[model samples]
Target chain A: MVSTYVTSSLILRILLVYLMVSRIAFAHDANEASAYTVQEIAEGNFVHEGNFPPQSLENRGDIANIGFIVGEKCVAVIDVGSSLHVGSMLKAAIQRVTRLPICAVIITHVHPDHLLGLNAFTKDDSITVYGHHRLPKQIRTRSRFYLESLEQYLGAGNTADHAIDPSLVTPVNGLLSIDLGNRVIELKSWDYAHTDHDLSVTDIKTGTFWAGDIVFSEHVPILDSNIRQYNAVLEELQKLDVQHYVVGHGSLDRPWDVLISEQRRYFRVLLREVRAAIVNDISLMDAVNTVGWTERDRWHNFDMYHRRNVTTSYTDLEWED
Target chain B: MNFVKRILTFIGASLLFCQLALATPFPEPDHSSIPEWIMIKQLMFGEREIRDGSDDILALYLNTKLDDSSTVPIMVNALMDQTEDKYIKTLYLVIDRNPIPTAGVFKFKPEAGRVKLETRLRFEKFSFIRAIVETNTGDLYMDQRWVQVAGGCSAPSGKNANDPSLGKMRFRMDDQIRLNEPNLVQFQIKHPNESTLASDLEPGYAARFIDKVAVEFNGKSIMSGDINFSLSDNPIFKFYFSPQAEGVLSVRAEDTHDTIFTDSVEIGTDKR
Candidate 1:
């Protein structure tokens, strides 16, 4: 009778220890699921700034700043990141903040980093997608290439769930106004600013301008449209009256006008050097490396895209009088 | 312990020898003190002596670090004036490492103002591109740029494979052809110029490209290009042509698919 009692006691102790350990493991996993930390830039405005990493399997394409605006009735999401995984995380962040139904997803442009995470909102029938008027055409023309590149970076298994659906997109031809319950958001589409199709959003209640790629703070300014038109847009942006701004890339540490001035200086350098090369009868091959090299230390990723920028500017300006 | 030490010493010695072998300069004739230039000279000119050009007479301009291998922009300008006596007669573009080393052989008349040509080409590997110019007296002058980019011949054409404009040609020039002064003429042809090494290709198809291009004026050949996949999809060329008399300028292009595209422009006299 004594031996049986001792054996039973030992079995009970082991079972109890196993159950306690499992509970701790489960709690640890729950903490990891809500790892994304969001900062409130303004009243009812929440933003999640991602790391400045290239699209890869490690980061899983969460390399852009994405945010949400919560009003009395609904929510508006600005730029949903680069993958479905990131979109899900952003959704979790929204759920943590408010239970308000997401009313709209505003895509700033057609870049994969800004536009690919759109499918995460497709499940909700009430949510509407908005983009510039030229967004649909760009999506159709460039999606396949983007998808192929994504697969190369992230394996096919990760990319299988991500895609661009043009049919669900509502093209924003001009100024469109949306009411997120009590707060009013104004969306303006510009002509060949950062891209052929670029839209900027402004919250009337908070005076915060979500200036997509039109303005970059720490990152180097990338030019995809006409340089002359891009410079013209920058001059016009100086006249806008806004309290705070959220750029597409980099930190919101600098003043808006300061960022614009710095970018303008860089572009003017490109223009002056490119025009000189053409007059001197230099080839496009040599101009790319030699032009705009003086500004190498001022911006991040200067070596990667600045040469391509020179190429784009040179070809376009060659046609100019 | 003694045997193990000897084995370790032997392994280290072998690795050092291998590194030394790899560090040896590429075995070719010395042309410009740059190894790639020496190799290129051997590949293109063989035992022939290539004369370094005077800065005032000839200069070649191209991107040294190529961004796009398939369509690298290149320009060759004769620094010397084009007079009735001395002018550039022929221009040869050679990409040493490309499967087809000779990219183009262009013959120009004195009417071609100033002897300047601008075009885009494909590069298969990181190699030297030499632009050799032959004057009327058979003097050869060479200018070369070392490019550090590859994979021009095998890049995919980001277009639909089956398009109606395949093998179609389009020609652009001033409405009126001027005499004496050089006028810019551009010709564009639609073809995949598909490279075998390109990824995202449909299974079972090898590669196809425009293999030959011939430009003639009134039955006389002005320039001819023996091209390869190094030409980008929808190959386009913009060059200066001086018209002495009103004649028909015809272009003929043949692809690896045996498809021929021909187009002609009538050089009308400019009254102004």
Candidate 2:
């Protein structure tokens, strides 16, 4: 009778330990699920709005908007976040919403903020990655530097097991349409704009447009490519009939046309002043400091990126005949 | 068998330790005593004394708060006018942290009334840009500026290699030519000045950059330089030249790929 009593107590202890372990695991998962919260902006479109600050350890490199669109049968992820941790959080957010398998991932550009989290979603065997035709070449050249930077920003431990495989990306030359069961999304490749290789996505059913880095809202628009071409692309984007839209950065509270026009006005002032500087034989060194001071108080992070925009415009406009 | 197993375990543990050591982020070493400068100074000067030139001989001008790493505008001006007895014969522009530290070695003639070089350069990282001028008597004087810029080496040179206007040249100067005085002239060449460290370059392809530049008036050298990809794309050079008479001011530039680009503007006494 004493032996039976001891066995019963032992079994109870084992069950208690199992329950504790399972509960801790469940709590950990719940924390992760809450970490990346998404809002259903439209009927089927979900977006996790990111902060406006630059990538830092505190932000975990989650400075760009990333989300997914669910269809009746499958889902398509617009962009993964800046790092694997952010991407995994996004994946958890998707799981919380629906159980549909992810069919495709559309990359916006070659910038580290948009491209680094790609490894997280590429793990699934059924997922196919899409990007501009020029993206693979850009990746081949830039991945090493981006990886080194990732190690610096997030510690080496967080950066471990992360690798960017450019070959996994299927090239989208001009316009390519993919079907997520009954719903179809169009991926468009653009000429040199924000970056040389920029891709934008549009959902046919919901009329939701993912502008990627092509259309930045509050945060200063970065110019990694030609300024004139960027302005031209902005004009082209103005014509699109976007019902619901997601910008690459900042809040989408304002109408899409207002965002594009603000960005255009910034570039216009930059272009005019820089061209005048060049025409007046003002040195590039002086142009950077004095060219774009008029629009100083208008934009966020203007102090950080406005000079760079001036530099880009000065160099490009100097070649003008 | 037991001994062998212990040895294998020790090897694996050592490997892990080595990786951990590599993974740990350490504070950046003090840049005041830059180790690269030590090596570069030894390689180039070889025990020659370099005096401070900021106060008397030359001045290096660059903004400490650099906006663009790939295209930073810089100017180096000689404090004294060029004369037969005391003239700067050679000017060396060096970025301490660039892959090719010596951006250019320019040779100047005493006929140029004043020496002022205004150009653009690419900085790989936050490092000192040194302008070391060698006088006709072989005296070395240096002026250095600390510039904070990064990632220029690995950033893609955005120019298209197959551009139709690859070797085109342009010249700009005052509408009226000044005679027997220091007249400023600017000339530029169209080349990518591709750096080997540019990340977007294809594998196994040699980086093509302008390696030689010669500026002359009436077949007499005014300013000539041995430059490299450390210069920014579409390299532009603005300097002062004194022409004794009406003559052709010409520029010839050669790239690493052995292609030469040449252009000239006739400086006449009357405004054209």
Candidate 3:
């Protein structure tokens, strides 16, 4: 009877310890997720962009994690990253999840925010940076400007990682393809939308298109593009079959119909305004002063962006055919 | 005959409507107030003070007034996103490119104030910019004024960055940091901070991005960092830190290939 009692108590003790430990671990995990409030937009889709915006000394947030998606063999990185440090962190993070080579880097557009980060990919033989043909040239010509921008944004003692070898530039134009063991990604360029060299990537299997700046989910679209070209591009994209997407600036989203409609409406209004200005023979300034922008109050940076859009539209309509 | 008349009327009406809409004039942004972030109260240029309380979070407040041309949301978001911490909060709000998009404020923690900086900004039309102070304890405070022009910061550096290389590093100082006070480090280095927004009148930027920097105090290592591509041209940074000993204050900088450059100053214990 003594032996039986001792054995029973020991078994009970082990069970009790297991339960207590499990509860503590589970609680810690819950706290962690809430602290960062990480919301994974797409499952099976890895993120490569380092913490939406890169690290800032004067930044207002406390969380920092590079975006990643794990693949079968070599993973696909959306934006490689800005500096060598970010690049190093990105590589380590990807390795943590998989042993795949960085198959290809898809630059959504020519903007520094999207493309400059590719310098991080060290294994040149295996990795390829896919962007519009105009991309490599832009990097070559706009390199200095990019450096200045770094100084303005990152401040001193922090730019150590911004060094990039311009000679290592890898440029591509037209359609590009990536075969990731089980998945196939097809990259297609948009004819003059956000930039002269805008490319959109579609994961054939998932039916999700990485829509660069062609679709900004949150803020107003900065106009590096003329209205006619932008409108035409939008119309062209609307005809394609896209179900899910990753926008350049805002959160990745589903339910594309509404977003597309709103973007289209904006362009339509702009075209109409410009068309009116031309007929009335209003000076460019007067025409800019005329858009009854009450609709602007509804959005955050509408006026700042709208004026640029209006200016571009007016100039395009006014200038060459 | 009635069907024919209906078709003709539709065609004529469409043409007339198009003409009327095209006949209107362009709209203009209102210029009324100053934008925020142009001032640093309590913290003067080259001034130092003890940070109150030892809590980790740094709270910074900014205010601004704006009119129609202000790209209010983008600039604000840019500022917020630039910080990356997300803990930075906006205590006040306003934008006047609309019915009343005039003023706003943002509050951030002490830890969030990585480096104090100054830059020319774009404040479409005209308006005041502002932000309030909120400690982790929940005290609220505010600051701001208006900017007169439309686009200033993004209007292009107007300097040709295509000139072969990021320019040579230039340094200036009064020979030493005033004793017991934070040292005034003035640095001007060649960098493009390329937005990739410019085109080459001449073919340039033939290499990868290169914006690397580092700073050390006395003989102790302080901090090293990577400058993002968003920094302005010929970058200028003025920072402060208290020193304990009088030693050679040296600055060493390098680019991607690890090509290093150095400059040093003799920090003496007493001033003449």
After TM-score superposition, the amount by which residue B48's alpha carbon in candidate 1 deviates from its true location, in angstroms, is: 24
Per-residue alpha-carbon lDDT of model 3 for A1-321, expressed as tens digits?
999999999888767766666776689656543333323456556553223342343221111222444456767776654555445555666666567677776666656666555567745767766677766655655555566656544433555356554445455567877787778788787667876778777777767777777876546666676667887888777787876666665445536766677777877877787887766655344556565364576444575566657755664564423
In angstroms, the error of model 3 at A32 is 11
TM-score per candidate, chains pooled: 0.63, 0.90, 0.48
Which lDDT tens digits does candidate 1 get at residues A1-321? Answer: 999999998787767656655665688557755667788887877888776645544355777888988989999999998877788888889999999999999999988888878888889999999999888766765576567656645532456567788878888988999999989999999988888889999999988889888988778888877899999999999888878788888887688889989999998999999999977756576788789899999997687678868866875676555
Tell me the lDDT of model 3 at B186.
47
Full ranking by DockQ: 2, 1, 3
DockQ of 1: 0.11
Q: Report clash pairs, candidate 2.
A: none
Tens digit of lDDT per residue, candidate 1, span B66-139? 56666688878888866669888878888777877777777777656677777777787667778898888777
Superposition TM-score, candidate 3 onto the true structure: 0.48
Residues B145-217, model 3: lDDT tens digits: 3444343223333334554545455544445456545454445455544333333434553322234555566
Residues B35-66, candidate 2, lDDT per residue (tens digit)? 89888998999999999888989999987557
Output the lDDT of residue B179, model 3: 58
Tell me candidate 1's fraction of native contacts, as a decimal between 0 and 1.
0.15
Any runs in candidate 2 off by more than 4 Å, and if so which?
A: A1-32, A156-160, B1-32, B199-204
